[model samples]
Target: MFDTLIDQFWSLTLSGIALGFIYVLVSLGYTMVYGVLRMINFANSEIFMFGTFATIIISRDFLGNVDGSKTLPLPKLLLTISLCLIGSMIVSGLVAVFVELVAYRRLRARGTNKLATLISAIGISIVLSEFMRMITHSRPTLNPRILEKKSLFEIAGANFRIDTVLTIVFAAVLFFVLDRFVKFSRLGRAIRAVSMNEDASKLMGIDLNRVISATFLIGGMMSGAAAFFYTLTYENTKFNVGFTLGLAAFTAAVIGGIGNIRGAFFGGLSLGLVEVYASAVLGTQWKSVTVFVILVLVLVVKPSGIFGEAVQQTRA
Candidate 1:
């Protein structure tokens, strides 16, 4: 195991970074919602699950690439991917907003117990997952090969695939844009304000509903993007796929600091690196166990995570 890991260290590192970015994207949704509402949106995983289906639907139905047997010209391929991205993002965003309205809004307005809200979110997650399970007949759905995945480059005996490189770069760009938006835009300010103090923001005439809705929307879109990359990397998805990935993303958010955006980003990459290395060195079956162990250690040592503060207390 040590020899194998040493031989594949660079390759594993690159793979881990790519996977980490996906976690980062998904964790952003959780962190953002927590930032504002101080509640974990368990249903956000279902939001991601929906985005995967949307990507499959667009690829299999609209693009007419069912089994990925057909190869497209570069232009058409780009168009197809763009359409899939847009469709996934839009559908996920809508589902997120709907979840907020149906599962959270009324309960929040009524000033119900936080446990009730969390339970409602979990119920929504179950419903959405089961609904998709029935639709897909509880089978794994394969994603069409939108891009011809080939090795683009190599460094230190490690070859990088085009899809992996693109996924990492694209996710990085999205993160940068999101960071800037959260820091500078008007709506971003509203979100930060609400996260800091919902009552105070409301008193200052900020539309809490609108800001909250937008926060969910943005987070959903990020998850959707992550979903697209996930399918792109893994080439398939299952109805319950969100369960594992969501757990990982939530762990990432917690490790980074639940309510901090930058913390989520760093936490995700850190977890990703740890998981891949552990998988290579220990075994594939030990991956989940290793992640949880790290989680427990982190909590025991520093419950506030790497950021040491929530989003409200930090600029993130």
Candidate 2:
């Protein structure tokens, strides 16, 4: 096991980082919603699921890449990629807002218990997943290979693929932009104000509902972006694809501190690296096991996560 890990260290590391970026993107949604509403948006996974399909739809139906055989010209490929990203983000963001309205707003207005809201979220998740399963007839679907995977260079024995590099760079830039948005923007200030003290924010004339909805929108967009990246790397998706990845992202959020953005990033990267290394050493079968073990340990030994504290108590 050790020998296997040692021999493929750089390869495993690069792969881990790329995969970890996906987790980071998805986990941001969880953390942001938790920061504002103090509720777990279980349906968020489905938001990501929707984004994946949106990518497929935009690429195949609209962009005329119905089959994977088309080799796009450089300019056309760039346009298609941009449009796909935009479509996925818009669709996922809207879907997220719709979920908030259908599953959460009424309950929140009525001041329902947290458990009820949680149950509602889970129900919505199931409904969305089943809806997609029906739409796809429970079959796996493929995304058009718009961007071919080619190794750009090698570091040590590891080859750097285009998709992998793009994923890392894009994730990093998006995270930085989001972090800045949350810390500095007016809407961001409103979000932070509400998270820290809802009553106080309301007194300050901050529209709680708008801020909450905006939070969902931003998170959903991030997940949508993650979906784009996922399809780019894997070139395939399924109705149930989000289930496992969602759980992993949720775990990442928890490990990094549930409401902390930076924490989510750190937790995701760490989990990805650990999972890859563990898989190489112990075998692929142990990947999920390794992740869960880390999750359990984190819960038991440091429930507040590596960063500690919720968004209400921490810096935005």
Candidate 3:
């Protein structure tokens, strides 16, 4: 019975864990930015899409070509990864910042209803995605690094690879560092205070603009890293790549409770695992449906999210 249970359950659980890591990395941005702004930047997804493509370009330049790309020296690989990560982070963050400056900042000053902001965000999202689609022609581009990594092990009878391990370990480290940054650091304190009461925090001499920008930067950086990890995993990308992934990560943000950092982490990880399991049980075709179902169920029970601020408290 135990052996049978292992055969039946371990596969989904392990795979879920791996997928969950990716989700967390992606979702962290949404959670962080939302915590401060209380505004959803729909274009955030496009920023992520940009990061993935940037990494692909960098990888191509570093390697010779796609199929026949030369492997970088280990030092170069490290440099490539670091430089690409930083470059993508800065690019995505700047885009996020620009969106705020152009689209949402003035409206926020006027105390616009979140609905208007959401619509504007969606508009920006569409424009950015369409522009990208036009630029890249909606074609899928390959990144062999993610797919080409050799499988490294069969842990507990489950196949695991270097990519899988790296994804998980990197995500864990990022989350830990972010948790510390948010909880123990001065910037984190400022961010939390603003989230609790933006105007009141301002009276306390907090620069709302700076705090908000910082939030975008952190989120953008996280999204950038996610771009790399995601590219590494799937090995190919295309225009609008960020849409579905962004929605899924946002769903994780919701399921875990928006404005709750830990909630995003748990929500993302949970969603990833659920997707993995769904692929095994219901077939991959129905997996997206399965995700929406989970979202609906979570909303019905815990509208505020698992670790999110209680609705009553936030309203008060």
Kindly list the per-residue Cα lDDT of model 2 for residues 75-124, writing each as its tens digit: 98889888988899899999999999999999999999999999999999
For model 3, the stretches where C-alpha displacement exceeds 4 angstroms are 1-8, 62-71, 146-148, 309-316
Compared with the true structure, what per-residue lDDT tens digits does model 3 show for residues 1-316?
A: 2453346576567667887887787788887778887766688788888888878887676544455355556776677667766776777777777777777878788988989888887887788778888988888888756234667877666677777788888889988898888887888889888988888999999999888888887888888888888887787888778987888888898888987778778889889877876677666788778888887888899878876664423210
Please list the residue runs of candidate 1 whose C-alpha ends up more than 4 Å from where it truly belongs after superposition: 310-316
lDDT of each: 0.89, 0.90, 0.78
Q: Model 3: which residue pairs collide?
A: 16-273, 64-70, 143-235, 146-232
How do the predictions measure up, each by TM-score?
A: 0.97, 0.97, 0.90
Between prediction 1 and prediction 3, the one with superior lDDT is 1
Displacement of the residue 298 alpha carbon in candidate 1, Å: 2.0
Local error of candidate 1 at 162, Å? 0.5
In candidate 2, which residue pairs get closer than 3 Å at backbone N, Cα or C atoms, i.e. clash? none
lDDT of 3 at 214: 83
Sort by TM-score, best first.
1, 2, 3
Query: Which whole-number lDDT from 0 to 100 does residue 151 have in model 2?
Result: 91
Give residue 264's error in model 1 in angstroms.
Answer: 1.1
Clashes of 3: 4
